[model samples]
Target: MTEDSAEYLQRKEFYNRMLTVYGRKPVLEVLQDNSLEIHKLHLADSNKPAAILDDMVKLAKKRGIEVCYHDKQALSRISKNSKQDQGVAADVIGKGFQSHQSFLSSNKKHYRILALDGVTNPQNVGMIIRSACASPINAIILPEKGCAKLDPLVIKASTGTLFRAPILRCKTLASCLKAFAESGADIIGLDANAPHTLGEEPLTGAKVFVLGNETEGLSSDVRAICNKHVSIPMLNNVESLNVAVTASLIAFQGAL
Candidate 1:
């Protein structure tokens, strides 16, 4: 390959392995995380000087990470969500982050996977990730959108478990489930009204437990595609458990 082609390929590979984290404190936290490798740090040129920003820059300099300054619009483009990016972003290559294609290609054994559908709460997302990380599940199939962004709240809520949990990033939950189904994995959705209880179900081979939204439960698109629905047996007129709690139970059970 020509030098220009080689350079383009190198840049593409770097981006493919990176996930951009935006915001002041969040970017700073990523910089503080000794386990993570930062490919680049992005700062908006329009940002006024602040103690935290200066610390971040100092930390980056101490770590020998290259810092890039961009205009506000350009930084937004790097973050992909202008309203929420908060004028700061960093390209991180954490061990926990991986693409669906990469995860699928690397994993060849029968294992349980947690697939989140429309789960928007960062705390719940963080807790679920912690459970998955502590359990026997292979990796979490986290959609790129329609869920909580992997921001500072998630990192804090997870107690930094988010940095170590295995994750397979996808564009959408539906698309990730479709790919899992095509790969011969059983797609099971958790439902309060389902006939089968989770404890009683005979889970076999590769399976993915689809956890739904905090309030609405599963989306229609996800429900229609689920091979089976499993419920947790409860008493005392309790309607349901929190999505994160349910995930923990399922994850630990799978581990057993």
Candidate 2:
């Protein structure tokens, strides 16, 4: 291979990770973490933190991780949610996700899978992953579209659960569920209006718990595919639980 081509090939092996860490707390934490697989760190040149940069310089020196200094404009463009980005970003590589099948079949039934229908919020996605990993769910599934991309916030929120669990991203939620059902996994959806409560249902017999978007619940088409529709019971003024919360309740119930 040509020298430039060889250089490009070498770069591909490193997982490219990025996150907008605003304020001092998260940035300080990341700087202190030696195990973090940071590849490139982008900081605004004008708004420099002399002390923190000093630490980052020392740590990067000891570890040999590269750091990039960028202007505010560049940082803003990279951070989609511009204002919230705390002027710090890091490219920490090292997470590779396996296909859903491998994740499920591995370890022979010690875990459960939580498949999302149309969850859009990265924050919600991260929270669900955190719960899943903490609860130690086997894997997580997200449709390729409409769902949040498995990005940096998610990784940070998951606290590395994104690496631990299998995250399968199918282009279509409906088609994925259809194929999943054919594989003999019972399909269940969470809806406040559903006939059965989550605890009331039998989850131990090869199952997939589906939670939809917060506002829309399950898509009608996806809901139509389910073999069962279960819900969480809410008392008093409560109408429904958040998508992640509902999923955790059902996931824990299904745990062996």
Candidate 3:
């Protein structure tokens, strides 16, 4: 391979090991935390310098982090949430986040991952991430669209676990699950009406537990791809647990 291609591959591999934290305070928090490893710092050129921004730049410089200035549009594109990114973002190379393609390349043969389908509530997403991070679940499959964008609210709701969670981002939940199923992974959809109970699940092989939206449950497209369906056994005629609650139960199921 040419030098440029080799460099590109190296960068890509590095990026797969990182997660981008956007918003001014969140990025700053990650930077201030000495435990975290930052790959690069991005700032929008249009942002007028303030004390916080100045501190960020100085800290990044002191830490020898590569700082790149982009225009508003470019920075928004990098952060993936233009409205809430606050013209700042950083690629954090923590053990938590990764790309699905890179994650699948690992030699691990058995694992449990959580997949969100049309879950638009930031709080729910955050709680799910927190639960997954704390449990034995391998990682969360976050779709690029049709879900809540990772924002400050999500970060807050996750109790700051967003930075330390193993998250795998994909372009689409359905397509990603389909790819996983094709690769001999077990794709299980969480449905309240499913005949199978969560406790009865054997939890074998490489399994992905797909959590649907709060109200509508799984989308037809996503549900159709699941190899099986499972539900939590509830009592007292309670209709169902919140999506996040269900996530917590499923995430910890293997350990129980």
Candidate 4:
């Protein structure tokens, strides 16, 4: 890589104020996914390349994202999991970031949304975001803390879906739940202990699917506001499903 190209990718890291997404695929996806101007791009090693890598170099140039070449060790050090930074990273300008108020509407009774009380896993969060983007859900509300952001692991796990979805935020789960009620979206508490099955209820109306943390599920305070509850039947010895699978099941099948 030329000295100028090396300087380019180094600068792309500046776009990550609220997010620090890493990995080659995730970074590339972010670079290709959005047209927003970027500061720079980081690459593992593009000095010597094959057909694919050569083409990738051209694309990087075409997008106006400065390309920097670093070794595998450097790339790994920069990634979230230190897994697959591949020699590529970027600092980009965020397209848009929405607030909690923007997620609500006073005039509508049928507004589909998602409220995640304490989801912590970036992979699960990314999967849920992928599901939400595919479903009719209007937006996903995540706590401002103790939750995943636009981490590279999430961006990779989300398969670039993060670029399309709108994730809202609140300081606390209770405040998010309160806003849900005031906004007129039915809150569906998905609990293993809940008696009602998601299938038994009419889920066509505007609703918010509250996916909880892996171990504790929804907190006592958060579940109290639920207008309805859902539980998938446990067949055989299976106790439960992953929260993303459960949520996706409810989103696609519940509405049918």
Q: Pick the candidate with the highest lDDT.
A: 3
Residues 172-192 of candidate 4: C-alpha lDDT, one tens digit per residue: 878878877876778888888
User: If the candidates were sorted by their TM-score against the true structure, best first, what order would they fall in?
Assistant: 3, 1, 4, 2
Error of 2 at 210 (Å): 1.1
* Per-candidate clashes, comma-separated: 0, 1, 1, 12
Q: Give the TM-score of candidate 4.
A: 0.67
Give me candidate 2's TM-score against the actual structure.
0.66
Model 3 ranges with Cα > 4 A deviation: 1-10
Give a tens-digit lDDT track for model 1, residues 34-75.
788888999999999899989989999999999999999999
Residue ranges of candidate 4 with Cα displaced over 4 Å? 1-29, 34-97, 254-256
**For candidate 3, lDDT tens digit of each residue in 48-114?**
8799999999999999899999999999999988988899999888567777777887857889999
TM-score of each model, paired residue for residue: 0.89, 0.66, 0.89, 0.67
Winner of 1 and 4 under lDDT = 1
The predictions' CA RMSDs to the true structure, in order, are 3.1, 5.4, 2.5, 8.3
Ranking by lDDT: 3, 1, 4, 2
> Could you tell me the lDDT of residue 127 within candidate 3?
93
Give the local distance difference test score of model 2.
Answer: 0.67
